[model samples]
Target: MPEIMSDTPTDFKHFIRIIGRGQRAGRTLTMQEAEQAMSMVINGQATAEQKGAFLMLLRVREETAEELAGFSQAFRTCSLASVADLSVDLDMGCYAGKRRHLPWFLLAVMLLAKNGKRIFLHGTHEPDSKRLYLKEVLPQIGFKVAQHPEQVQVALDTFGFAYMDLKQINPQLDDIIQLREQFGLRSCANTLARMLNPSHAAHCLQGIFHRKIDEKHRETAALLNDANVLCFRGEGGEVEFNPLRDVTLHVSRNGQQSSEDVTATCETFITKPQELDAKQLISVWTGEFDDIYANHAVVGTLSLMLVLVDKLDWTEAYQQAEQMWQGRDKKWPVVLPEDKSEVVPFDTTGKHYAH
Candidate 1:
């Protein structure tokens, strides 16, 4: 048995014991225990072996809402709590890298930001080159990726929206997210990062590729007691919905659970963007190019959040989103990097794990 003497530094051993017993022998941790365990990991008190064992053990079993909330709480406790007191209206989680689409959701967020909605977007770019991640596309489209919380504040102040890298919010958890390449499996880090809501924004929007994870996000939001949360199976596992398909969203507003469906409004089906060029995002935003699939995708995703925040009703939300998209600023300062040589090249092995 692992020693458990009082005042000893063996809390991780205890956590491992609880989570890593033979599949049938182990049980899930209580909410408090889960929070403590995650805290230990984030604070760097746990060894790498212990972190791997604990995360992999939890991955084998789906995490409970209680466990997710506890883990998020631990991360929130350690995240940079102060961010220059910027007024943020939404916490957008964008973890799933785009594979089949051009991240039309970026255009949607930009539209909202232009309309004076302070959107705080945070995500990790998986090290895969075959897929287009937001961080890689942001620069190409003349948007800045924030490396720190203060920069996030500045971006929000300047453009009413900002994209933040999860690594900046918490490197320890980002390190765990990177472990996907080594373990060949995604652990709870991906899920937990979505719930970070580091800025404690009242409303959170999450997109996942799987339906089961959609429900998990909804339930976890309730556990966190967030005022508003909207989640659904989004395009390519992002928060962007496919305009060609009816999307059923799980929502938590004011601690109440509800479901809403954004019916397909497009006449044609589009499995992928017509073009994958990063410049196309800017062109779409500037009205240089018009695409039915991408247009409705932006409107559909914006409407979901508009309704979730009680800013508008379903019908009104769609109408308003369309109007917002139609009137978006075509010339929102595009500052390209002077030197493109510093760009990180992505690995093109293309073995994407199920997000």
Candidate 2:
């Protein structure tokens, strides 16, 4: 007797069908459904077609807060392996590289690190991306790049800062992110990646390019019950506060039902960069150069993160940030090529291992 094969489609296909049911009938996924669907996507249970379809369908409509929250939870649960406990004071995401200007924000982060704030910073740069990503420039500034989770843990413990590329954090997610080459547009993967907050830090900072995604990001953190989250429209989509103009970023403290709005500290709207040079980031940090705009950008960015990281009010954070800037070592550290010590300044991903 021949046995009959069932015609049931894969569970992931239901997500595709529901999401792509045409504008008139399509509805967003519930938080639970979103979590389950993203888990399937991350775990390789979803067919390639289902994965693409679900992402594109959701891309057509901005993701709801619940969808963002659900997707973030799934990735955290399904990360490549248990990430090391870096005991990071902050989780900083830097997916977007800088183009119009140098990434002065690195100075802010380094300053905070020098003052004893351990930061676990993670990012991804597409194969074809031309922007000045952290991986390309950090070494020039005498920083060491840790390729593994254990390196990050040790870096944080030793130097108070660590950087990892997303590919090392979870190559699976990086593969999904690199899909932009095929899709010609961003999928939810791009948005969800920033909120992973792998260390489960008490304070997490996410910067978005689109204003539309600001509230959604803050809402997602709130939904995740993240203790402290700052989601803002950043300069060049990196986590730097634009010091030239007034702006607003959302903050959620202890998973507040609604996030509060935080505004920029500077109102000056224009400054001139005589020329663009990645080396300027180093020069500025070492007190060898001064760009009014760059200095404000660094201090402003630091103050913004300080509000959450140190629990200081915005005004106090800004003033303290200035003092930090003034008190920083006037010269960049020299990491002898022979010295591979954890105390040496580090660069980005090379290997990732759990502690």
Candidate 3:
């Protein structure tokens, strides 16, 4: 048996050696071992070589549910301030999708807020390799990212929306991003990062790309006991209506789980952009695509929100979302080439503007 260190290892060299040995032998890390390894990485004590090894091991094979649970608990312990008084019924972890469709997450959050629902939206915009992120776009829609947990609550109370940047809220976790890039592929960290719910919100809306991760996400949330999570194989990994098909919504709420097939089979709801020689499909997503797509996303969101608030029903929620969509006079802001004309290179030190 490799002797377990009594004091937490302060450097990445030990982390790499431990994780690599476990991976090579086809062994899994104990929950304790996993937490310690991650803590070393997050706390910036790991050496560069160890950081790469740890991330690669996790990338080659996913984390076990036990390990994931341990990591989540450790993360909460190391980061996140206690805000026991604030009750966040919903926390939406919005990943920037492959197809940069107009960010429906923001729209959904706004609608939920208008209806008097408390919500928290948490994410980061690093590895800006492709697609626009909420961290970059929320300001365009008139929201600012919260600087602290208290600010998050205040924003939720006042604006119905609160943006929590992973870096600002948990600098320790943020430190691992650069090291994560060294591995050149998304490992468990990418998945785990989305699962970070700082608000300790009992309800979550998580969007993922891989189908396998969906069940794991459910198990992870169930482990937390208090969380009622909805995991969607999002349209390109973000919450947007798929132009090619109806969206698949997999919901796990109140310990009961179900899935709804939301395919866009109607002609009114479907459009052939290629035939129209539409240079891009951008116009439709920004323009009115269909009442159903809008309603589906809203109801899907509300279903998660409803899990938090006992008074809301699916039918009533859908109707409410439809009313909101109909009331909008103009199309939501969809990013275009012109939108990027003024974008300064992401300044690490400069303040982030939402647009």
Give the C-alpha lDDT of model 1.
0.77
Q: Write the per-residue lDDT of candidate 2 for residues 1-355, one digit (tens) a residue.
A: 1111223337678777777787888788888888877777776778888888888888887789998888887778655454645577899888887766677888898889888888888888764445567876676656777788887877777778888888878777788888877877777777878888877788888888776688888778888888999887888788888876566768887678444445655566654443355567777887788777888899989988888788787789989999999888977655535535333222222331110
lDDT of 2: 0.76
Q: In candidate 1, residue 348 scores what lDDT?
A: 33
The true-versus-predicted C-alpha distance at residue 193 of model 2, in Å, is 1.1
Ten contiguous residues with the weakest lDDT in model 1: 1-10
What's the lDDT for all of these models? Answer: 0.77, 0.76, 0.59
lDDT per residue for candidate 1 within 305-332, as digits (tens), equals 7876654767999998889888766875
| Model 1 / residue 120 / CA error / Å | 1.0
C-alpha root-mean-square deviation, candidate 3: 7.0
Q: Pick the candidate with the highest lDDT.
A: 1
When summed lDDT is taken over every stretch of 10 residues in candidate 3, the lowest stretch is 272-281
TM-score versus the correct structure, for each prediction: 0.89, 0.87, 0.74
Query: What are the per-residue Cα lDDT tens digits for candidate 3 across 175-249?
Result: 564343454455565666677877777667787776667677777776665346777666567644443455555
Full ranking by lDDT: 1, 2, 3
